[model samples]
Target: MKSNLAYLHSYKQRLAFISVSVAIIALSIYFNFFQKTENPEFSKLTFSETKTEILPLNIAKFNPNTLSTEEWKALGFSEKQVATILKYKEIVGGAFTSKNQLKKCYAISEEKFSQLEAYILLTDEAGKKQNFKQNKWVKKELIISGKFNPDLYSEADWVKMGFSERQAAGILKYKNYLGGSFVSKEKFKECYMINEENYAKMSPFLLLPSKTPADFNPYKKNYAKEKRIIKYQNFDPNLLDFEAWKKLGFSDKQVQNILNYKERFLKGSFKTLDDVSRCYMISPEKFEEMKPFIKLNPDNFAVNNVVNSNVEMPKQKTDFAKIDLNKITFQQLKEFGFSDRAAASYLAFRKKLGGFSTKDQILKTYNIDKELTQKLIQMSTLSPLIAEK
Candidate 1:
């Protein structure tokens, strides 16, 4: 009876072992082949072939004007299809004038257009007309029917000539910086606030000379024979008074003009040597002569100050603590001396990437400079938790 019991226990152990082995084999087969084959996307396709497969579409109401490149792709459009739509919009002017215009694109077939028709939103005709009128490039009717000197036109006068209040103020401000008058039509045209179309319409009525006189030397009292004596010494252009500028060979009028520019246009200080160089009254030759003597304070040479300036300034040395790239804020970036535009751009790119996994990825941000890139790399740290995700 004891022998019979022993044999039964031994047979049960062997059966149990075989059952476990079979279960393991079945699981391995499922994982290695059956599991992958169950999903059509993973089955029987090369990498290149998989890439050609269409991504699922997400349809929603969208304005073509505000829709981004990625948003277009999300709406079931192929890369070529998205590019064609964008190109058509660009060719016709920067935006689609109407929903019908977008529907007419070659990439957008009638069937596709039908699918998107209910979701398309565009500006009304009245709104478009208002936008067209507000465009600076659009030619306005001539309010001043006869010849008039733009130099003498007051802010109100400029408004009467069809310029907006803001544009009129800009013109007047620029005119004040140029010694209360425009020397020539070409110089007047150089105002950044005025577009080519507006200038062309106003050109025929402007009474100023078409070009400045070759002999007209703005820095000197007499261009014929008088040579003003100048004393050169190390000086900060930002700190110079009217007397100091006159002492540096500038005429009294030129000195007053420079002071006016420094106080008004530059908000009472020169941020860079380039700002001093750009004074409208300072002739190029005069600036070159005094360039060596100008010394700006070292503290004024911040990264933001020199980014747009032609003058090169050394970046201030800083030891930044490592920061998680995924968690950095726009205000934090601004504290590092980034412009509003650059900071916004960095944030937008980071959002598009989900989150950065490495320091090198920050380099791909639009408008980021090499110096900023190096600083970013030095200060970046990826969160381990984020990396796993």
Candidate 2:
């Protein structure tokens, strides 16, 4: 009976020991996972909430190289996260060249990267052939059938013209960087992704002009004797009558067109010699021939009195003070006797060049005449900073 009692006691002790072991394991698990820690940086989110935070709600195929900050935000990254991603890209040569490279960014956790893995489009050794095949299939499906103006095309329009979405985005980004439009087919072809095959396929359908106006040579063909014989005379184009224009070697039709253009566009009289040069009927060679003889005096209205009484005479400002070209304002330019168009042109050109380095640079401005250019050089001085630069 004593032995039986001892056996019962031993069995009870073993059961108690097993129960304590189980309890200890349960407590360890609770402390490791469920219990709040001393670490303030540790997230207290539940497993489901943690999953929600890591995985983006929206998933779409996107090139990491072209994603803007807002686009990254749209993909569920915080501002700081997006900044980190962009900094990573900049450190790695301004673009994410591969999905694996993007996955290495610390801003994107392993879970997040795994979630985004399939949606990331990048050209890498492993995927290059597949992407090429996919792009080929896309091009075959979307054939460019009709003529299209690249200047007017948007990113979507370029995609429809057989360019991949990424290529279209790149084209548009380059176009915007080049003041929002491609000037010529050659300029469009200069895009980094545009290959000779692509350019050849698209060139015939591109509705852009064959050559820029500056590149076109009117004298390429031999001119007739009568067309070549232009009389040189000092005359204001604004004051010239139809007979006077005819005497200048223009045909009757060309003379009438010039007169009508002046009446319709110029509000009766030309404001500057540049206006006269801009007449569509006048060729570049013809304008160059007449440029020296085309005298435009805004202050003198004796010709206006004889021709049209409705013409308003511009105020004359003969006295001038030497001004700083770098500090000159648009109003100051106008006060210094520059026409509104000329003043605007100078400012625009100045902006494009990031301020002129030399007085001769002013001569490079479009619509500015030699007379005005000379006056500008005589009256203006460059800032010390600009001169030193």
Candidate 3:
């Protein structure tokens, strides 16, 4: 009986050992060949890149004042730029009439102005209004045959030669803007409205002198000399009528600009010599010649009319006697009797500088007159304050 029990136990132990060995073999086979495994090089895979292309502008001739928002976009103006144009027009009462005026818009860049300059056109009414003229610019039927001198041609002459009223006026205005004569036909081509085709057509009729005088200076001094002796003895720009301004060597366009500048500011009047020079139409040499004759009251001139602008003149008391120009704030500048344009300019100038080191540097401020500089020096002490301090 003992031998039989021992035999049974030995058989059962062998069977259990075989079952454990078969289970180990199956697990090893499954792990080695059938179970799923992750890829090691997955992170190193590359993808095709996508690229963007810039589209060229589709430009066309259109009046900027009347150009729709869509038209402005087609002409390459961004939405922000288009909004700026509309806002500017709304503030200024109408569209731009001249390249100089257009450039004065804060949003318009020099490059953008140059690109769109050729397409700008002022309506007849707008042109006449800006030129300060009441007479209709065009008076005759079309007759496009003539060899005419630009300097000598009248509006009637221009109209007879196929130029529109606005084009004729722009040519005349450009000539006068040069103070009455162009130095060369090439100079005449600089007119914004004078395209290559118009220039080519008018080149044959240009009356440029065959020989420039040996002493001929291109500064327009010779042309200015031919005008009636400047009768502006101690004239006040603040009180002068439009005709009186014209008598002071200001062209019609220039007179309009002066009046516009005066009306655009709070006081709407010239406070210093630098103010006169700020007008784009007035050259430095011209300003110097007229400086001694300029007269302004010690008190600010009161203008009845005020053209609206975006810059809000904050009411702040800035005692010039206690102010430092190098450390002046934008609001303080306005309080110091600077126009909004001039005040903004001062802030920009100071931001670019590492503080002012000398009294002479104050003159470098935009539209700051020598008289104003002298006043500032008397009123406030010039300190050597560095930017970091």
Candidate 4:
């Protein structure tokens, strides 16, 4: 009995020792809780006595479909929105055509394009776009023979195709505008969609073509889709020599003017037929007649009325015109308080990005202001193009 009692006493001593040790350990952990911050992003947190909660850019980027609520929060996606996105991804079987297409996801608002932009793995978008672009198809090549053979595109072919001699010459000269150099019949077809039968007729010698699996028209994708939507900026004032315009009710003169202006201006919009007619020396009566027949750009239209209208209030004038938004020299934009670098950036974006869509688009630039954009627009309005005869 004495031995058992001694053993129990020893066990009690050992338990007491362990209890005290555990209490010490617990206190240590509690006192130094802030020391647990060890992430690289948290390294800077030490600089301040008050710790900052730093968000880390995951080394392995998050997949929106599989992201947890916490991860979604990092991307500014609410829990409900994240769940909806996942459900949508499941519906499409994990196939996203493009990041742009993701905007169609009911849960992802168009406003989210920038919010979740960081988390999006554009590998899928880029891969899909590349696949579409590099897609192969059988095509026809139309090599014209005879007088136009030097260019391998003949005036007779153009005329038979319903193209006038001048229009034919324009087509030849417009080769770069059409598609630089044709690799497949499908591409050339787009440039000559107006005369498909004529293109098909000459297409035999132009060569019935095919694309290899690796083939792609690099420059073909450079132009925007809306560029070829219509015939021309100015329509001929007389009558459309072809049936498309006749069936459509546009006269040749109107069609010619539209074509001439579109080619001349480069930018697609015509504020009024006067812009085109004035360039061609056409009368106001003829201009007004051609107005209804002419199509002004629905989305993009401009008038150069934004000028110095201070005919009387020379001193009271406040400048509001867009500095020849297209040709505003970098040096001048700076005087208007635009930093040289930022002004340069705007210039480059405008040139490479087709054309100035709206003053709002420019205002949304990284460092520009809404007020300044308004001022800029009022200063320089877009001009109508005059064809070089």
lDDT of 4 by residue, 169-211 (tens): 6665555554444545655565543355444344433542544
Specify the highest-lDDT model's number: 2
Model 3 / residue 140 / CA error / Å = 40
How displaced is residue 325 in candidate 3, in Å?
A: 29
Q: lDDT by residue for model 1 over 98-125, one digit each (tens)?
A: 6666777999877777777677665333
In terms of lDDT, model 2 sits at: 0.67
The TM-score measured for candidate 2 stands at 0.29
Clashing pairs for model 3 are 262-268
Q: In model 2, how large is the Cα lDDT of residue 26? A: 99
Query: In model 4, what lDDT does residue 254 have?
Result: 45
Clashes of 3: 1
Q: How many residue pairs clash in model 2?
A: 0
Better of 1 and 4 by TM-score: 1
Tens-digit per-residue lDDT, 1-389, candidate 2? 99999999999999999999999999999878665565544665445434455445556677676678999988879999999999998897765656677888999988878778877655343543343564455223224545778777755467655677688789877775555667678678888978765665566568886665574332332344434575576987766776778778888767765765565445557778777776656867678878889887675334432335433333333223446786677887665446687788888888877778787888767655445567556745676334211
Given candidate 3, what's the lDDT at residue 338?
Answer: 56
Off by over 4 Å in 2: 1-61, 65-104, 109-236, 240-275, 278-311, 317-327, 334-357, 360-389
Please identify model 3 stretches exceeding 4 Å from their true place: 1-228, 303-389
TM agreement with the true structure for every prediction: 0.24, 0.29, 0.27, 0.19
- Report lDDT per candidate: 0.66, 0.67, 0.62, 0.50
Query: Using alpha carbons, what is the TM-score of model 3?
Result: 0.27
